[model samples]
Target: MTENIAESIVEAINLTKTFHPKKMPAVVALNNISLSVRAGELTALVGPDGAGKTTFLRLICGLMDADEGSLRVGGMDVTADEQAVQDILSYMPQKFGLYEDLTIAENMTLYAELHGVPQNVRQERFARLLDMTGLAAFTGRLAGKLSGGMKQKLGLACTLVRSPKLLILDEPTVGVDPLSRRELWEILQTLTKQEHLSVLVSTAYMDEAALCQTVHVLNHGRILASGTPEELRHIADGRCCDIAPTSTMPTRMLQSHLLDDPGITDAVPVCGKVHFITRKAGGGVAFLSKYPELPKATPSEERLEDAFMILLKEDEEKRSSNIQPPSQREGDREAVVGVSKVGREGSIDCNVEGNASADTDEAIVDITVRDLVKNFGDFTAVSHTSFDVHRGEVFGLLGPNGAGKTTTFRMLCGLLPLTSGKLSVAGVDLRTARTEARRNIGYVAQKFSLYSQLTVYENLRFYGGTYGIPARELQQRIREVMEEFDLTDRADHVAGELPGGYKQRLSMAAALIHRPKILFLDEPTSGIDPLARRSFWQQIAHLSAKGTTIIITTHFMDEAEYCDRMMIQDHGEMLVLGSPSEIRERMHMPDADMNAIFIAIVEQARAELAKEGRKPA
Candidate 1:
């Protein structure tokens, strides 16, 4: 290591890790990677799933020993002095364990005692942590009842009961909402600034990576690039453009079309426009002119994501002679004709001249909820919520964790009963004919719900059989869907053994086997990579254009931009409802990014509730 051992907080020299299964091929979790982290700095390790980020963090924290090479944490040899290294460092894995049955105060006290914190100062430290994490008010509440975001915060607090010299977090905000993510980042920033803490965090979000003082991009167990956000953005400089679609075309449609061009490195729908990067530097203009229907493109500032995608694409191209990049897959281009046909059959008419709730003409409504309410004993999960979703529209439901988004979605999909009010799907009242209504809809749950022990093909076949498709037709449909999802090659692979992207693709494939009119996706892109997300959204765009109604719940705020309309919910109540642009205009923050807008809306809602002499749940 070139860096002084006394000055660097963490250092790794030619480190490698390999995992050997009993009968399977050896998996290289980390290659010969070298890096150094200076004291009192926030260093980020960013990559897609299966990129060895977790392994690196584990090695550094002495949770796992490296197979070869040297590693040091807090100026101690991690492999030789594992306990000593661990004593000075705190590691929070992706799934942090907390005593759910205990109250927040009890959990914090337990962790503090375990860390050997002095009783004299423990009370003061606990008070500060709870206040800083915004959980002081909920100190007496059971940890199990806390929201996902709250649980994450509590986990952080427990880890920090007695501050270690180094803190390592693995995907700390994986499924956290935009507002909660902002809060968590604020806490981390304050610790780094005021306490002079050293943090090594692994994350998949580019936005989070941009916040770090230094970032290392890892892929397939190798360190591909390392630099500051500004330094990395230069890699894609002059190749990025913001494309405004013509009035006749949707932003997603234009984005899908742009990705079809081989020269276009990457394309994503963002803020009512398509942000894309080209393969050649300064070739953005030339790439735009290829499609006359596209509006005049403007040069946009390059982002860290643009550079990250460029680097991944370049690396893929260099490795394979016949690179079947995810962006250029033929399966992604398949037209989803089922969406349009379903939309026409289920379109709803609203009186635009007067009240938005009044129907002016006879039309189909894919999903209808009126005065919907769900209660668990005395606690209300959903409170008199009402909404109408037309066919072929992409409707987004966003909220912080434990905001009842899932409850509403379950009721709409006929998985749960409403406490009161009417619910309908595809013109069939779910309250009256839930079984029949379910036939017209497909649902992909937040977690992987497929049989993990079964192979991909077996799982698809089983789901198809349950839907009552004939044997011959089921086989044919399974083959076609697998081919469309680019999973034909992995047909025999165990579902549980697949990577994050493949697992997601298999989940969607299984859901669409019956070709339902409406599709419900819950955090579909939660843990996947940027490339996989692009491909998944491309398929979504195709379905939407073909007239399929999509209802989704997501934590990624940027994804709200793709929806025709979205609703923000908190504390079992709707806060805002409109298109992304309309929401921005309503909040008087037209130029603000989605994260800022989300935080502002939620905070504003909480303030309004306070003024009304009511707490937000």
Candidate 2:
């Protein structure tokens, strides 16, 4: 191996971390892991929860000390020169240390002064960050009042105030909107090129993985694999394929069935499809022939997640092959149904030419604005905005923080009162039939909404009971949900104790308990691992198969493709609503991801609005 320390900005050698537990022996957080990060490069630290991603970031930032290992930043030892490391590094923790009550400008100024950034430099940097993050007009707005995505951007700006050599971001986009995420990524790209900054960002988003020059896959407190996206993809060994099934069951069934077959290795859900990894050659074709109803086989490119799954499976297989204890020699169990499905709908509303379900040949919607209007203290948050939802959508609602996606959703769920215009669910008006209208709804909030103190089972029970489900009926429903979400073991765990994915799963199950006619999901998949997100969508697909309509709003554009339709709302105005493909077509841009399209749409809309002498948000 080449040891070019002169060019390397971050170097780690045999790094190990351990935590002492009250009742048990010391637990190793990182074990003999070695890696290097270079200047002008973005590195992604990826893995499931409890995978030591946070620990790794902490060690690099000198937030904590390693038990046995060495880490160097800018040729300075992290353990030996703690203050020196802290001085040159910008570490944005997963929970941004922002005072919510502070104004955006105040927050930036606070951090800048602490870092002793020159007044002139601070003003220049603040202006650039505010404009780039689209918070130029909202500098006086309270940080707490900002949307999740905006808050993330402000936190990033605060971190950048000092202009550190190395930037460490931990799950920075966990709960932001897609447009904001795209902007943040663009800013990072600019910083890397202009400042030659080294960025090490930890994320659960696979799409973000593509932006990184190097991706380090960590699991169970150890580095599993590391490489560029292209190099990592080869680990799949040509077994991955985009297998379109006749329906969703085959996807899950195939995932389970493949585990039982010796030739197959692993299967992960992605973009309304299943990515299967199996041994190369004759076995895949022969096994696939067993499911003739599905579309004919076609070799698909391997994604980063696919490679991660393949490596994880191979790791397991290697462990199994070793002479170890029986506890470790495990066989494949029945694939549980609790994981979410892909190609799930984005909103419950779909516009049909004549019939209610006629245009739904595609799943997911682009947008659905139903005379959505809201008011507070005689102030109108939204006016009578009427729009339709198209299929395969990644719609966005843009505004300062309160321009009304939440308000619209609240009314749709009968949580808020609407002043005017018709609000329909699928085809039924909520005013006339709220119960019937909400049968298909799912909703997730920016904050944790489920019972934090209650166990997972108790929370689900509460939801089922509130829906007036009979005990006998509810029990079966609970079992099915638990199985589908892989929450069976977590059934007894406290809701607060569960990881982000499990909490999200419980919240979803609660929303879905009624088996509603349509689903209303608000930011449902934020703040979870890439694998967890894929698994969550798997359940969404399963629900869609039962003909349940889904409506969700999110800030992640990678997720936009899963929707059947989408719409973009800015300053309470419906800017655009169409299929993901149509949205791209409207922008006349190909190969532009959903986030990029959203940016273009908002920028173009703002430009037109400005030319008309109208204030744009």
Candidate 3:
């Protein structure tokens, strides 16, 4: 409200949007939301999926018309002078269309031409962007051949081919690795500071939002709050604390127990500790006394995410009490085997007795990869990689986009064959007995792979039937799963029509219809909102506690902290392996967060590769 209208880069007054599909009921995507982005400032629209962030972005870019209200961009009426508004702003959508066959340089050239950049200015601009993005060496590499992180950087370079008054990026770092994410932020920050560029970015990551000058929190088509990061942090003042577990209980268990308390607003496991927020302001000490089982609690600095969740909790409380807390779900399922205590190095000691059966007292090593090698002609995707995943352990596989993480996962899941190696999963050799190995594992692909036309219940039934479950049992199981996932209300809804969060839940439920011993998730929380991500991980933690071995790949570095052990790879080679804490200590940056550590490791690997005269693809 204090913004100067004359100096604002973008302004919206009483903006509203609604969509009417062919047969479905009209959906109001945005309610009467009013906000402004000041010139030369970075503004963030922070929200969960289906929160109208994209709708607002599209309206400002003149890609769609608002059903009501008015919007102005660069002091021009967006609806009246749409083209003029567009000419002064660049928009990078969730999926920026870079031709796969085009090289990085060619893609930039194409976008530059489309924007009508003068030929005389093209060379210098291209040089600056390439150098800034660290893609100068890969200018001739086809976009299709570039790694996921590289492709994102290229997409950004293309978008910046012609400097505009404002830049709008929608979830630009959805699947980008930690290193690339940091690089992209650096570029944007440089542009904003030196060129006086105005940017409006919609993001799911709270840390990214914290970097913005102003953040607008949206949910259910409404703006929950808007303020600077510090101002937002004040919302949770004196309410946040770190609760350390007294015993060896998993952090997830402590988190679940804390969340069950009505006074608690939110609780999440972070760095082997539970960082929790309470509803009562200035009640940290009193709250600690209520949980005597927990070790001495200490006040912690509030983060933007804490404030965001506090706002969301307040909103939810005002709305209704019908929604159940996530912790209200059924007790954890029993694990197939027991796990060993954490070692001095903070690594889980898997008491592995070779090839133990389900009835045996000794624990079994669920997955074993020894001397694994995968080849595509002269290129190696995985080289002599060896690791063991114990039953019920949360094992994380991390790397930059083209680091062969996916290829390694494919071979382990029996989806891809290894050129030469020994691979065993669930006591079955993946190379020689793929069917048996696959039967013991469930895989949820990165993308939604369920039938879009089928209803949620139908999809569940189909998956159960595919696993050859009895019709009667399958029906009951589907109902139970639907209820557990909070999908019972959406049972009749088509899978494709569901929100991103619901689609993810349905996918996981379908995959678990047969209750496989191991679950494989690839970037499961990529584009979801923070709250949805918390719920998703809670389910994962519950499943792991119940004795389900979980193997996952994710670009969100923060999620890595939850894993018992993790393996970091680059260019088909393992660079580091250990618990999150151990890896941080090895890097000798105890205070550095996961993102910093990940960037450091990848950079070190690339440096070694350059020394070896090997350029990463």
Q: Give a tens-digit lDDT track for model 3, residues 1-617.
A: 26788889999999999998654678889999999999998999998788899999999998899999989999899999999999999999999999999999899999998999999999999999999999998899899998888888899899999999999999999988887788899989999999999999999889999999999999878999998999999999989888664434455566666776777888886654678888886554444565667587678889999999988877876777787666544445232112344211254432211222233335457898888999999999898888777777788899988899999999989899999989999999987899978888899998999999999989998899988899999999998889879899889888888889899999899989899999999899998877888889878877877778899999988888778778888989888877776677778987566777888898988998899998754
The local lDDT score (0 to 100) that residue 455 gets in candidate 1 is: 93
TM-score of each: 0.93, 0.78, 0.93
Candidate 2's TM-score reads 0.78
List ranges where model 2 is wrong by over 4 Å. 1-3, 18-28, 118-121, 124-138, 145-147, 236-283, 286-305, 316-370, 376-381, 387-403, 424-443, 462-480, 513-518, 575-604
Order the candidate numbers by lDDT, best to worst: 3, 1, 2
Q: Looking at model 3, report the run of 10 residues with the lowest lDDT sum.
A: 336-345
The superposed Cα distance between candidate 3 and the true structure at residue 268, in angstroms, equals 1.8
lDDT of each: 0.82, 0.70, 0.84
lDDT tens per residue, model 2, 1-617: 23366777899899988887443456677878888887778989888876788998899887788888789998899978889988989989989889898999999999998898999798788888888788899999999878777888899999999889999999988766666677789989989998899999999787788799888988767788888888888776567666653434444444444444566655553444555666763345556667677676567777787787666656656757764311101221222323223222322333322112433445343234455677676667776777654332223333324456777767866678678776765666777787766655556665679998888889989989987899999999999778766689878878876666778878877777767666677777666665556566656654554445566777666666665556566666667655455456667775565666777777787799889998733
Report RMSD (Å) for each prediction in the order shown. Answer: 3.3, 6.1, 3.2
* Per-residue alpha-carbon lDDT of candidate 1 for residues 285-366, written as tens digits (9 for 90 to 100): 4445766776777788899999889887787777794957655345435553223322221122221111132231343567
RMSD in Å for model 3: 3.2
Alpha carbon lDDT at 198, candidate 2? 91
Candidate 3, residue 163: Cα displacement in angstroms equals 1.8
Better of 1 and 2 by TM-score: 1
Q: Which stretches of candidate 3 lie over 4 Å from their true place?
A: 284-293, 333-361, 608-617
